[model samples]
Each structure stands twice: as C-alpha cells, then as structure tokens.
Target: MSISRLSSALVASLLLFGAACGDDTVGTSPNNMTTPPGVDVPIPMGSKLQHTGQCAGQVNCQVDVTFNSSAPLQVRVIDGNGAPVVGAAVRYELSVGLAVGTSLNAASAQTNSDGVAQVEIRAGQATGAAEVIVSLPGDTSVAPIKFVAGVQPKDSASYSVTFEHAGTASLRDIKVFLYKAEDSCDAIREDIARERDDDASTNPVLTAEYTANGVASVDGTLPLVVFPGLSNGQSFNVAAQAMSRDDGEVELAFGCTDSNPPIENGNSVNVIVRLEDHLPRLKGSFDVTHTFSITDAICDPQPNGGYAGVLPSGVCLAIDLIGRLATDPASFILGEGSGDTGIIGLIVDFLPDDGILGTLKGAIESFLGNSLIQNLGRDALNEFFATWIENNAPDWVKGGIDITADIYESLQEFRVNGIIRIEREPDPTLDTETNTVVGLLNADQDGNRPGKQVWEDIIVYWTGDCASSAPAACRERTFSATDLGATSSVVEGSFTGTVVPLTGEGETGFGLIINEHTLALNYGVLILGIIEQVVLPSIFGPTVTSLEAALNELLLLVLPGGTTGCQGFADFMVDNIGSSVETIARNLCESLLESASDGIREFLTENLTISGEDNFLLATPTGTPCKLVEPEAYTGAWIGKPLPYIDGLGTDSMLCEWDVKIRISQDTIIETDGTFSGNRTGF
Candidate 1:
C-alpha cells in the first residue's frame, strides 16, 4: 500500500480506539455532564473579533514580515461578546502576483486561551508585491485579513541604449552588454551565458536580447534594454558593439555612469550610440636626432719667478699657453644610428648598479694623459728639450744629456649632470573635416573639460649614478662632479605641436621635431694630471730655470701647474689645435644624450601600439551633428600618432580628435577560371 493510504488507516484505527475508551476525562467528561440534550452554548456577538501583529517572513514575497528573517505572521480571534475565542482553528495563506512569480508558505495555528494564532511566512527569491491572508475555520460572521508587503531583488544596474550606424543607418540585432567598470564586457557576458560546452562565451554583469528592429528615422526610440533591478547609486560600464557584413568587427560606443542619475526607481534612461569608420593601426619604427655646437675659453696663469728663476726671459707668449694648446670647438651630432657602437647609440639603458661613468671613467684618464703627448711627436719633444738647454743655459756652463722622459696621466675624480624632456600635443584646428576630428587638446572653452593632459603627468626618471669613481665625500655635493649619480631628472616641460587627428589616413599624422634640446652640464669639474720625469744637476748644473720660456710655456699648457703639480686645470679650448681633450669629453656626453633619446623613443613605441583590432572604444565628445557619411576602406599604415585612451566611460572624458581607418578587400569572381568574361563578385 502507498504511504498515504497506510497513514490514513493508522489514523482511523487510533480514532476508533479512542472512541472505545469511555470517560477518558474522568468526572469532567462530556458524557458525564448532565445538561439539556437539545440546548447549545452560543458565543456572544461582540466577543467574536480579530487581532493581529505583523507577520514575519522567510524565502517568499514580502508581507508584514522581513524576507528571510523568519519573523512570525500572527492572528487573534474573539467571540461577539468580547471574550477570547479559545481553541479556534486559524489558517494562514500566502499569495503572489502571477506575472511577478513568487510563492507563499502554507501554515495553520490554533487559538489559545487568549485567542492568538501565528505562522512564519517566508519570502520567495523573486521580487514583487505579495499578500498574506489569515482567517478562522467555518466562521460565518468574521472576515479574512490580508497583510501586504513588497519584495526587492539583489543590487544591479539597468540601462537602455539606442544604436545607429553611420548617420541614419539603423542597426538590427546588436548585442548590448553591461558590466562592472573594472571588468571586461566579453568576459562578464561569458560567465552569464555559458555555451553548450559549459565554457563561458563571455563575462558580463548583465545582457539583453538581441535588438529585433531599430527605427533610425526617429530621434529617440523606445528602449531596447532589459536589465535586472539594481540598487540606487550603483555604477556600471555599458558597451554596444557588433560585426558588420562588410567590416570585420566594429565598436559602436561605450560609456560608464551611475545608476541613480540616469536610472530612476521605476524608469529607464535613453542613451544614444553612434558607429563610426574604424582605422587600422600600423606597426613600424622610426628614428630621432639632435645636434649641437659647444664653445668655451681657457685662461693661462702667469709664471712665478721663484719656481723657475733661471728661465730665459727672451720668449714672450702672445696668448695664454693654455689657450694656444686648446683646439677649436667642434660640431657634434648625437642619436641612435644602427647599433650599440653607432653614434646615436651612445645613450644606453643602465641599471642601478651600472652608470655611464662606470664604463667611461678610464676614458677620462686616457684623454687627460696621452692626448697631448701623442699630438706632440717624439721629434718635436726632442728638439724642445735641446732648445731648452741651448737657449737658457749660461754660456759658460754649456752641456746637456738626453733628457729621459716618462709621461703619466691620472684622474682623481669627475662628475657629469644631464636632463632631458620630451612631449607631444594634438593639433587643435583640425576637427571633423576631411574625415578628421581635432580640438581634443588641453583646452577650456566652457570649463566642462579638464585642462590636464597625458604628458603633463609624465615623469622621466634616471636612477643610476653617472660617476661611480667619484669620491665618497664629493658624491653628496649637488650637481658636482661627484654628484653625477642618478637623481630625479625629469624637468617640468611642455610640447607644442600638431597630430593629424587620426582620421583613417594611413600617412603619419603626428610629427614632433625636437631641435637641439639643450642638455647642460651645469656644474662639476674633471681633475686631470700629467706627470713628467726629468733629472737636473744639483748645483751649477743645468736646472729647469736654464730652460727657455717657450719650453716652460709648453709645460705650463699641458700640465696643471709648473710649481705645484697637484694643482687642477680645466680643459677649456679657446682655439683649434690638431687635437683637443675638451672636445673628446664634450663628444662623449653628446653621444650619451643621443643614446638616451633612443631609449625614450623605444619606450614610447612599445607602450603605444594601439590598433583597431583591439576593439577599444575611446570616449569622445559628441561634436556638431555629422553632416556627411562616407564608406571607404581603411588601409592600415603608420599614422605616427600615439594610441588614444580607450574605455573613458565613467571618467567623463573622450578621445582627442583623430581618425581611424579600416580596409576590407572585395573578392573577385569569374564564370571561367582566369580567362572568364562574365562578371561575378565574391572571394
């Protein structure tokens, strides 16, 4: 037998057994009561009444109780005479609107001595208004009581969008997506509607049915959005994109907004979206160059009689010996040319541990030591020593041994300081003409747009020490030779130029010509030493004093000082000799700057390779109504402009004026293979 039938049989058997037991209530049994057989006790009219408290709720639609809180629904009954109706059967029922989709918890309660009854009514997951009913069993005079409440869904955002393609062309079956501002629309959509393989197609917070029809002729059409209920003030990103029969994939438009402003408690917002011609971005490389000329003067010091008392006084130097030894300032161009050793490759990426000085510190010493000696050949040096003895030695003391010479160059310390700034701006005049849009530059006409820009916040930093050999004591000095270590080098600078506003034009639209940007080495000094060895007789023998002033001048020009060899001198060239040590140092720094430019260029190229295939929709201010619509193929070429910022939704911003181009090749078909004459179109 079925469980139900067996339970009924058991209940009936128990009832029969109870009836067989006589006077179970003892002296108070109804059978022992001696009363008139036909008479019946009637409840007073005023005592029959109703009383109740708000019914609490759980998993059902809202009523007097809070949903999921498990609060109890209550009811009370009384007789017509105002006395409590004890032992009365009370029933509680729940009902929901059919369209709203919710259910009620069924429960029954018995009135106690106080005529009170209650049941816990649960709320359903679905949201909508619902009613709870309470009534007594077979009551002729009492009416039922209905307690009503409204259920609310979880938090979400709703949006209504209207789409148009290339002016008045209406688009059908376009897919719309809403997602968290920080998430990807495609990823979110996949999670919401997984494919048959159970793999997510895309992840989206919410999605709507494909648009069946769109009336492009009208300005504002009925909404094509159906979103779940959202809490007030919630934010979301909205994207509407689709692929065309001709175009591969196109981004119509996207925006971000708070649910409160555009979405009312019971109303929807109307968003207008327009599709535009997309341009393919090109991938290629280019070069940068900077040239400069530097010149300075060198001063010579007067000789001291005490240091060279026996020197011949006949030779008079016209200009300072140091100036005479100096070479004319030369012109130098620095940039990235071909490879590491190339002229432009002087600048290189250095880690915190490696610096320019770390590699070139030896170069400084070589330039100071061997440069002048190599220029003055051995013959010239031999004649100079012979002349020194012939011209200055007293006539009575004539005699000179071959003056053995050993030249050594030493560098105790040096420092170099450098700064570089680069920037790019859009052309404000070109806008929406010739299929181009401009005026996205930093401007404030009505003040709604922010004047800040991308480059304004850019901070270029150099973090390594340029001079690792610098003395520890000198390293702390700011802008000094020892201070050549890396520091914050970005300068507050601006660029004024024009980019062709990316208008599907494959030609380079952005061009910036940075002329000789001055990279000044403001402070710091190089300590160079030229140590020479020679022997002189102790008493009346030929002394350094016996040398002619010309030889003395030569020595003074090359060495730091005649008396104190420890003195330091600056390698400033006032004229051009055959070779110049100053020129070499200057060239090294220039090459360093050029290498830096190469690095900066590479940084920009790697960071800014934006393409139409990315399908990113940048925000842009709606310009004046589009007056012309042209359908053309976009050829991917070097536009030479930085990729515009995309997904500017909730940010309340848009892309600067620019053009994007995309090209789709049409297929050719012939009735006969290659020789066919009949016209056919396809690929």
Candidate 2:
C-alpha cells in the first residue's frame, strides 16, 4: 500500500481505537443530510420521471433523483380509505440528462416504523410510465405528520454553566459578574487598572452587564446570555465568568472584547469548569475545558480590520485563551526597505467605550505587545509602516471628462461649415480692413513692447439660445487650479479692429478659442502624487498591516481558545499577506450586500452557485434584479460583477460576486450600475 494510504489508515486507527497510528482523523459518519418526511410514493420502477416518461426508446441512459427532505422523512404506502398497502412491488423509470426530473438507479426503500418508502430508477429503462400508486391512508391533519428538519434558533442561544463552591466549605456572598463578552477585555483591563465608577466614553462599544449573586453558599444559578444588544443584524453570544474567589483557580468565564467574540455558534467544544479548594491540585492539575461544534455557517472572518485601534473591553477578553490569542496575535509586515515601511499611526480606541481602557489600558498594551496605554492615554502603539506601496495608474480625470471619445474627437469641429469661398454674401459690398501692412513698425523707435498690436476691437454676433452644458454644481466652478490666467497679460484678440469678443450664441463651455496664444501643459504631478501616495494606499492597503495585526489580536481575544480541538484557529487569527486580505475583502463585500440578496438560492438549494444562477438572481431593495435607472447598460464599477473571468466552465457563465470571483460559470451575474444619487449635508 502507498505510504499516504498507510499513514491515513494508521491515523484513523489511532484516533478511532486509541491504537498506534498516524495523524489522520478517523471518519465514520458523513455530513448530515436533511431527513425528508415519511412518504409512501411507490415507484413503478423509479421516481425519476426524466427518461421514464417517453424518451428512452432509442438510447441508453440512467436517471438519478435526489430526494431532499427536511427530517424524519419517511414514507409508507397505504390503500384507499386509510389502509396500509403491504408488500407493494413498485417499479420506476429515471432520466439522466436534464434538471426537469432526475434518473433513478437502484433498489427502492420499504416502509418501516414510520410508514415510509424510497425507490430508485436505473438507466437503459423503457419509455413506459411506471409508479407505485398507494391509496390515501387518512387525513394527515389530525395526527399532523410532518417532514420537519428541526432547524431554528436564529435568535436563541444554548449554554450550560456550572459553579463549584469551596469543595466541602462554604462562604457567603458569592458574586459573579457577567459582562458582555463583547467588551469584557477592556472592562477587565480598565477595572483592573483604574479606580473609578464614573467615566464618560464615546464609542457605543459592544458590552453586556449581568450580575448573579454569590454561588459561594453552596449554590447559585449561572446566567445564560441571549443578546448583547447592537441590532443592525449584528449578533453575539459568548460568556465570561470570573475566576474562583480563590486563586485564579476558580476560573471565571470572561472576555477581552478586543478580539472577535467566539463565533455566534462556533463553540464546537464545551467548557467544563470544575471548582476545587485544594491548593496544588486546583492550581496546576485541573483543566477547565469545553467541547463544541457548529453548523457550517457562522464561521466567517471579522470585518474592517477588526479592532485595529480599538480598546477591547475586559468582558471581550475574559472568554478563553484562544479568544485571547484571537484578540492578541503576532503580526508583522514585510518591508521593502529601511524607513520605506509605511507608518500606521494609532487612530486610538477602535471602540472607545467609557474611555476607560484606563482600567483595561495596561492589559491592551500588554495585549498588543505595543506600547500603547488605554483610557489614561493610548493603548499599544506598535509602529507598523505600510508595506503597501502605491503604484500609479493613468490619471483619472474627473469633472465630466468621460464625455465619450466619439464626442471628444468630434469636438475638434473647426468651423467646417461652408468653405472659405466667400460667396461675397459676407458683405462683399462693405469695405474690409486688411492688415494693409499698417506698416511693420520700426523696432528702433516705436519700442512699444515690440509685440504685435491690434489697435481695434471686433464684435462677432449670433442668434438663438444654446443648450446648457453645466452639471448642477457648476456655479462655484472657478478654475480648479491655483489661478486662472484668463485676464492675464496673455495675448488678447478681437474680431473687430485689433481685438475680438467671443460673441454669438453658442454652448457656454463648448470649445476653446485662441489665436497667436500659447498653451501651458498641466502635468499635474501633485495630483498624481496624491493618487499614488494617498489614494491607492488609503483605499487598498491603508494601515493594512497594523490593522491586520490589531485584528489578529481581536480574533484571538474573541474566537474560542485551545480548549477547543480545532486547529488553524490561530491561522485564522492573523490575516496573512496575500489571499488573506482578498478573502476578508470578499467576505466584507458579501456582508455589505447581504441585505440585497442574502444568497436566497444558495439557502434554498444547499449548493453554492456560479454567479448565483438566473433563477437565483438576488433582488435589490425594491425586489428587482438590479433594474437600470435608465434602461442603460450596467456601467457601474461594482465591487464584483458577473464577468468572463473563466472559460471552459460551460455556457450560462456569469460573473460571480460581480467582477471578483470569475471562475464559476452559471450564466448569472450580480450587477450594479454604481449610479447613486444621495443628499449629504457637508460639501
């Protein structure tokens, strides 16, 4: 046998039977599937109606039907008027090519305890129709049979808390403070460092305040949290208990809210804390732990460089060690050169709850491994220069510069009307003043600045009004530069004698006119520098390194601890250099648009889609698949759009997540026209 296979077996053996083996985890059960309700649909051959109808005449084929049931899904065949049909041999036919129906492939299930049966249709079957027709058993309403999956609890939490009093001894006033795991850390740190009860703090930081009287006198009930309060679809359910009234041995579940809190339902392990009064045994030998496993969902990355500059609440930090690590992780940016490392100034107080990092401040400084002080000052000032260098792309001209290339090229219209063949209709009768060499001046005597002079002013006239070409906010549209040279000592001209007024009715901002005048090129190096130095870095990787580090800290403080057997939880802590950022960015994007679609189709069909199929086009706020504001093309630079990112993925290819993930091809796309009109108070 191959080494890999042998290793896998050994690991499995070790894990399953406690026998010497390799590292692979043993597997006995597969992922769970929804159990359908008890049904008695007899299969004449198979339930696959695909090829069984009439398409199996001239070709070989197989059919497969996946029966998706909620739960406790079983079926029983019954005769008319409430009688069970016994030993009914049912046959079925199935087709394999299309989704309209599926092809069947094997033995059918027979009714057991709950009156249920299953059937499969195989390939190369006849075109004849076949089915197991059983009589109605009885009115299902009375007994009310159902195919319930037993899934709910989008708003509830389940947890068990145990408190152990001083073994055989007892004390009075056993108090347990249940602060929000959301802000536990900062609270812990602040409570530990500061000496006050009242303080004003900004930042509506997440936190919960719950207190249960002493469990000392031998008994007391531990409280379970259901909500932490912010409801912008935001949710959290984590616990933090105070350590033993004895030496930290009587561990209290607490949180350092700086890091992300344990996922809403991500605790796959249970936290079993047994209280002990013994000195050494309780101090070194006892292990406080928990076992928890969660649904595939809810396991998501935190948003916006979590806790970058936020002071974690003590309640946030008191959860578990992993939570600590999640809240506090080792992070660094690979620099390009000395001093070139971009700087990340502590914006301070990611979440300035009570401004009391003052208490928790030391803890945060200790936590960040940086030199920042909380409440009293800042907490952990780790200098992480941006490794995110900005690269310059072509200048992005604003101010309606995208006026269509065609329109622009055509704007070169230089009076291409009737040729210069003056039909003499140009007042051929009137006397025209030709520069008759009004004589080249004598540079020696008439030293009047020696420039060409037009001793007269000419006026050009036209009729009819022109179209308005200004956008709404163009009134205060003065020259966008330091100054406008319009009235400067530049060459001035007129249509009359020596000068000309740009007369006539025409588009106000239509075109430029100049004669014998020179134009200055605005290289706009300053603007270019701003785009490269400020725009790119700020937009793409701004303070990313430090923020990532801070996020790692937050994740450690919030996610579950090593008490849980899951690995890579730490890896999940730090946002590594590459795809790490991309993943966070994508998930954030998904989070942002969650309200728009909510992946309804994916939820409906347990399978992810390629740009979410056409049938799954997520609706916008108005319940439309991104209706155009004007029947125009989708031109908005949406984050991710269904675009041709991958080929050979078959037809029906659409851009998934807009332009981000392109490999998936299902011919469906989430489109956005970036066209938004909103009112803002500021300029």
Candidate 3:
C-alpha cells in the first residue's frame, strides 16, 4: 500500500485502542471509569486542559493541511499540581466557514492513562483557516485549549499578462517570462529559453501574437505556476520580448512590468508590461593604436666608486601597440610593432647564491682565449701589463680583488602583440522615474552587480627586433611571430559602467561609458626572454669586445723588458674583469628581474587601461532612429572621445580622439561560434 494509506490505517488503529480503554467519567480514575446515564458530575476543581503531541504548547499549536488531507488534534488533562488526571471526559469543537465540511473522528473523548486525548480532523474542499477548541465537560470556569489549521489549495496560482508596445514595427509574436523579483532580466531570458529547449513541458508562462502595425496591445492568460519556495502574498517579476520580421530579417523589442505583483491563491493577477524599441546589439571589429614612452634610471650610484662608475647614465624605452577589438563573443587582437629609438635599461645585481661570479669568469676567459700569452708578442704583453697597472693597481694592490660592476643597457624600443577573447552581456533594467531603460555591460552575463571576466585565447608576441650593430647572438635571439604559446595570466576585470541612449547635436544613437579599469599582464616569461636573449647579447657583446681591443692596443705600447711582472699584472686584470661580468649577470638574473617586472606592471596599471569618462558613441544622422535593417546589418562611424582624465596617453591630443568605420550585424551568435568574417581596415 501507499505510505499515506498505511499512515491512515495506523492512526485509525491507535484511535480505536485509545477509545476502548478511555474513561467517560468527569475526573479521577487511574485508567478507566464509567458514569451513570444522565449523571451531572462536575470536573475536579483546578483541573485544566493542555495541548500536547503534534499540538504541543504554543509553538506547535498551528499547522497547514491540504484539501482532503487530515491532521491530528491532541490535548492533555492536568490538575493544578501539574500531574496527569486520567479518566476525564473531553469535548472538541472545530470552527466553521472554510472549515464547514471538516469533520472530527470523535466529538467527545476521555483521557487515557497518560491523561492524553486525541482526535483526527479531516479537511473538506475549501481553502482557509480552521480552529479546534478542546475543553473539559461541565468545566465552565477553566479555559479551553485552541489549535489552528490552515487549509492549502490543491491547484497552482494563475496569472495574466498584457503586453503593450509603442514601436512602429509589426510584431509577429511576443514571449513573456515570469521570474522572481531578485532575478536579472538577462539571466531570466536565457535560463527560461534553455529550460524550454531542454524539456518541451518547460515552455514560457505566456505568449501572444499580433499582426497589426504601430502601437498595439495584446493580452494572454499565463499558464504559470507560482515559482517554487514562494508562498501566498509573495511578489514576482514579468518580462517580455516582442519579435518583428521584415522580409527575411528579424528585429526584437523588449519590455517589463514596472512593479512586481503579489501571488494570490485561487485567483489570476493581471500585469501590464510596457514595451520599447531598444538599440539592437551590435557586433563588429575595431582597431586601436596606443603609443607611450618611459624614461627612468635603473640603478643608483654606489659608494667606493664601485660598479656604478661603469654603468650607463639612464634609459629611455618607447612602446607602440595596435589592438583590435571585436564583439559577438568578444575578443581583442593586439599587434606589436617597432617604436622610436631610445635607450632601454638593462640593470643587473649579484645574487647571494648560485656562484654567478664563477660562471661569468669562465665565459669571459673562454671569450678572451685561455692561452693569452702564447697568442700575443712580447712587446704587446709588456704594454698590456703597463695599462693594467695604471688602471687597476690602486684597488688590487690594497688587498684581494673584491669588484662589483653596476651596469645598465639602453633599449631603443619595446612592443607587444596579442589576442584575447572575452565575454560581455547587457544587463538592462527599467528606470521608473525617467521611463527609460538603461543597461550595464556585465562581464560574466550575471546580475546587475559587477562580475569577473576571464579573458580567453590570449596569445602575446614580443615583436621588437635587435639593432643592426648587434652581434649574431642578439640577432639570432629575436622573437618569432608564429609561435603562439599559451600563458597562465588571467586578467581579473569588470565592466560596471552604463550604456545609455544618446541624442543631440545632429546625432541620435547609443554610447557606452568606460570609466576606470585595470588590466594585469604576467611578464615573467616575456621579461626573462627579453633580458636573456636580446638585452644581454646586444649590449655586452659589443662593449666587452671594444674594451678588450683597447686594452690590447695599450699593452703594445709597454716595454718588453719586465716580462714576468707584465704576466702577473695580465692575470690579475683578467680575473677581476671576469668577476665584474659575473657579478653584473648574476644581479640581473636575480634582484633586477623582480624590480623590472614590478616596474612594467606598474606602468601598465597606471597608463595602459582607460580611466574617467571614455565615451564610445555609435551615432546615426539626426531624425533617423537607430534600427536594424535588411541583412540585419548596420554601417556607421564610431567615435571615441576621452574627457577630463587624459593621463593614459600623456598630453598627446592626437591620442584623445578616434573615428573609425564600423560595420556590424545582428546575425552573430555569441553563445556558440566566436568567429567573424569581414574586411579589416584602418589599422
């Protein structure tokens, strides 16, 4: 048998057993008692009735019962001393009206051995509140115990929505959705459509069709059930989308009810939704070129005339980036190119570990040829010894050589190129006061709040080339264009600004306001590659060779007499030179790496991303309403103007304004394929 049937049988059996052993007396038997017919016996003085079991005390006094369902009413008889008073007669009375057809299994019951009396109440066809009063028989002075039951309806609540549109297009069909008050309109639309596609039974709450032109109104009885977890008097929101077809192209207008309506049981609520023509979502390709320059000193001068004495004065690095932005599964394609010639900084500091000095000594020795004395003549060796004595004798003669070189290399130009795919959706809400609807660009397609956007398909390329004077090593180490490697860098950002309608000055359309944004780029691999492959070889290869050549010339001028002393001086100079190179390389690989990384990050954070009111406006001719046309295409000029804060692009007025031709179409599907086809221009 079913669980409900089994439960009913058990309750009936328990009631029968209780009745069999119950007492009919007014009071005072331990288990069972009998009273003579027509006898008027008063209940024991100070006796009272107390609700118990499922109806225990005040907390469990009320319960909800569905139609045709039953609930048990229980009570206990206790004396003033709080002890059980068995064999006492009890009376029960259920309220009327909504509880008219509700019946009790017993009108009167005597308390059992435990002084507990119980009765089952079965509800009828109506839905409302019902009360049951329990009192002792012939006890006029004692108060009665009360229990409450709320009768719930058997059917789901219904609603009706009326859609009214002010647009001139002839609507083919209008789809209506019912959502909770807190749900976003964009999420509701996507969720309901997904549910219906997954299951045919999950169709929208209401749909209406119309063939008339201009403004029109249509109403439909919504086949909607109150949302789960909602109760009577709770409110819900209504949203609608009206679609119109012209030739083979389709356009859509949206609307929503201004206020949420409460759910009423067994009744249909009427809601009026006002529709307005909104800007069709535009998907297209855009290109932006940014140029900036940075000039900074790498290392501060140190004490004792150490490595700082040989370091380059300062560095000036310039960068140029061409970025392409596209919508309909949003993406950014960045192409890096050569910048103006300037000094690029290459700073190196020695690490505490890793024996960097030894490595440098070996590398320098190999470059200079290990058997220096065998290769040079006696006269050249004498002159080399004399030059070394004059330059290094003061510091070296004092004690064991302890040399540290703080050197800096200047870079002419820097550039970067990459592509990043991102997701964005318009989350719109109605403005009651202005009677207009505005939307915010949500990165994650969520509610009205700011959402984190994870940029995908990020491919960055280092496009800077080595100078012509650079050695073969530097030239061979140039970055390759075809190697598209994946990076773990994820830029956490949000687009929280508003997209509002624009009208005035011979222009009518929409503008998206971008206000203050931050983008982080992981430069670990890129920076290391630049330093190791490009900067080191380009600067050190030429500088070290020139220094060695000068020393060899100076050595030729010395006399050939003191050959032994010359050899000793030559050995000292070679070791100290090797030590200095090693110190510089070690420092670059360790401390300077972190410092450069932080500097680049800070530069991007402060100057790359746009800040303040950067308006991107898509405008059509005045008096021409922006509307989707045949082929679902729109061709116009997009204007980007940054006002107030222009710190991003420095003081270059040319970087403040941009005008580009935008060719967009509504045919692009963002949820599926992210590919787009068109002629790319104006880079």
Q: Pick the candidate with the highest TM-score.
A: 3
Candidate 2, residues 210-311, lDDT tens digits: the string is 433323322333222122112222322323344333332333223222333343442211222333221100001101111111111111223532221111
**Of the candidates shown, which would achieve the greatest lDDT relative to the real structure?**
3
Tell me the spans in candidate 1 whose CA falls farther than 4 Å from its real position: 1-206, 211-239, 242-273, 276-492, 496-500, 503-683
The per-prediction tally of clashing pairs is 66, 144, 12
lDDT for 557 in candidate 3 is 33
Error of 2 at 257 (Å): 10
Quote the lDDT for 622 in model 3: 29
lDDT of each: 0.30, 0.23, 0.39
Error of 1 at 187 (Å): 18
1 against 2, candidate with superior lDDT:
1
> Candidate 3 — what's its lDDT?
0.39
Q: What is the TM-score of each candidate against the true structure?
A: 0.21, 0.14, 0.29
Q: Which rank order by lDDT, best down to worst?
A: 3, 1, 2
User: Which runs of model 3 end up more than 4 angstroms from their true locations?
Assistant: 1-199, 204-211, 215-248, 256-274, 278-424, 431-435, 441-495, 502-511, 521-683
Residue-by-residue lDDT tens digits, candidate 1, 1-683: 99999999887664443222122211111122133322323444554434332121211112322234333444556676566665566667665642144444446655554555545545556544455666665464565654444444533333444444432122223455555645554454344334212234433344443222221212222123334344555445555543333333332222222231444553434455444322212111111111111111111123442111111111111111111111110101111112101111212333122476545544533532453433332223334334433554434224321111100001112111222221223333434545333323342444322211111111111111313465544322222222221221221222222223232323222222121111111111010001000111111232332112222332333322342111111132212223454444344444334433344323322222222221111111233111111123323421221112111111112112212111111121111100000111110
Candidate number that wins on TM-score, 1 or 2:
1
